[model samples]
Target: MEFLNHFRNGLVEGEDRDCFEKFLSPHVSMLYKSAIRMCGNPNDAQDLVQETLFCALKSFHQINDPEKSKYWMFSILRNLFLKDIEKTKKRAEIEFDSVCDKLTDRKHPEGDFLRAEVKSNLQEVLGKLDERLKIALVQFYFEGLSYKEISESLNIPIGTVMSRIARAKVYLKRELLRSESMRLEISKYIGDEE
Candidate 1:
């Protein structure tokens, strides 16, 4: 039969099928967890996982270390998620620009006030970050690069990348806390006046 001929052709050999199932099946849960975290929605997470699995299947032969398959799968997932994020961001930017153009003709005082407050708070916190820390955070979080990729791109060691990201998180937390405390103090003062 044609099925026998296909099997004889080595397209779906038993060894390849066994290797694929062995390496990929055990990591399905972890992959789904990572996909959910990256996507923030179940449907999108499922799609991401499916896409990652498809790519992994097509290139499973390239995975040299079976022990490191989890990390390899993660790298693939992360890369796909980052590409999706980039495309989404680009679309969002275009839509936001058009919305902003339309909103410019309106006079929404409360909206303006809220936007200014949020912008100022963010700017203050970001401005307090060290230049290197800021760059690392931006590249890792916003640009969606892996620590290894960021290290290569920035010409820094992997250890340095890890440290910078860790330091950036600490600094951001401290700055945010300070900003919140200041805001609360101002709110208290205004309440006392009224």
Candidate 2:
């Protein structure tokens, strides 16, 4: 928190901070309310709000319109919240001993080669996804965001976020199957989503 304040103050300075504050002050309450809803508890919500303010202050220089500041701040807040969740999740998911053992797996050298080939091809296939579907899928799977977070970040309905990710997965499955080598390799590992 101290680091964040120093970093922000070093960048924002005097006049710029004042101008940015004009855009931020009016919506502080609104931002707090939204943060509380998203975080599900008051303590976490307050921390999220503090982080949001620092982030918004850092990037406030780029804003060309005062009117857009509200949404901009909201976006910053949501992104910070999602990032904090992702960090916590990653830390909790890391099992050092098991991970090292898995990384050095000697059971199937050929399996590792095949997995690498499939992963490479998967990237190619992922690139073939429609833009909107691709965005939702990447955020949900890679960034580990909930459907609600994705919806808010993308400014879409939760249902729409789900639909896009579902469609993207279906499209990826069909495309992977279209490749004979990928199908032969991955089919044994992946079950039907339905």
Candidate 3:
């Protein structure tokens, strides 16, 4: 009967709000510190804490075991933090590509031809990506969003994001290697004069 009451009270809508507030409010400082440690910045840590709490509240009804609530909440936070790390990595890759593109298209044309050749090869590789992988990569790397944010924005799973990125890299590697071979042949034809 006591377990039943606890389970029943866990799902109580208005009642749960007060309980959630009382339970979670006391942990805000700890959550924020954990977030900061995971995220490495105060602003991002705050956002992570808020996002974790919001997710917890939205899914609280599904949590029937009050004794396990802390574990469940921490799970949500850990997942978000890991997703944020992947997002940051993707963003860095995208930014590096963007900078390379800009630099290749602008100055540094007369120094080394191998660098230009590599950049062109990479661009060709990028152009060969399928539409879905292309879009996922763009959203993740170019937009600098977490997996959860990308999932919410694109209405796709976090796993799909991971898979798409993996597939994209495979395709890019194949295309880059092929392009490098082609560049070698083309260079022979064009001659290494000027």
Candidate 4:
């Protein structure tokens, strides 16, 4: 709520604002999580999510199907991330190690350490993935979009979506498994890649 509220410029008509609140609310957290993973830092991730939400709110009237809004919002996020990368001609400069420090100031249980390690492994693996494969994998696994939704969102055939997702899994597994510190089995979290 605060995130959207901060970005609100008071320019949207009352009715449009209400519509946006209901329409875009469900996908905001998901978008933010994806943005953080893509941007590798909370600050840039928040900016990216804000831009995505603002862009979607302005174009909410163009959305036809409510069920499809999830994919549409993701399309906006992916496009913005890719566009930023293209314009800058480089990946973000933020260091992934800083995320761990920002995640918590006080240590807790062993599970927290394990979770952080897993997240670190994932972020590193995802960073190493080819962009074409990374986008599809994030959409399916992170955003929980169906294969068809990803295909439509990326303007690719369903078969291509399946292939890219499969390829991404292989790359992730290989890289993560290669991490000596990443002893935790990824299968439980990775889902059935087959």
Please name the candidate that would achieve the greatest TM-score relative to the true structure: 4
Poorest 10 consecutive residues of model 3 by lDDT? 90-99
Tens-digit lDDT string for candidate 2 (29-68): 7666666545546667678777887777767778777676
lDDT of each: 0.60, 0.64, 0.57, 0.74
Q: What lDDT tens digits, residue by residue, belong to model 1 across residues 52-163?
A: 8778777888977777777677667767876886676521010122222332323555555544454455555665555557656755765567998677545679999999
> Model 2's lDDT to the true fold?
0.64
Clashes of each: 0, 0, 0, 0
- The sequence of per-residue lDDT tens digits that candidate 3 reaches over residues 140-189 is 66545567755654457899978987798667655644665544543444
* Candidate no. 2 TM-score: 0.50
Question: Which prediction has more favorable lDDT, 1 or 3?
Answer: 1
The TM-scores of all predictions, comma-separated, are 0.51, 0.50, 0.38, 0.69
Error of 4 at 96 (Å): 10
lDDT of 4 by residue, 1-194 (tens): 46666665554768766766677777788888778767868888889988888888778878888677877888899899999988986564223454344433335566567657866676766666788798887668656789998998887899999999999878767787776555344444444464
In candidate 3, which residue pairs get closer than 3 Å at backbone N, Cα or C atoms, i.e. clash? Answer: none
* Ranking of candidates on lDDT, top first: 4, 2, 1, 3
Candidate 2 least-lDDT 10 residues: 90-99
RMSD of each: 12.1, 11.9, 14.1, 5.6
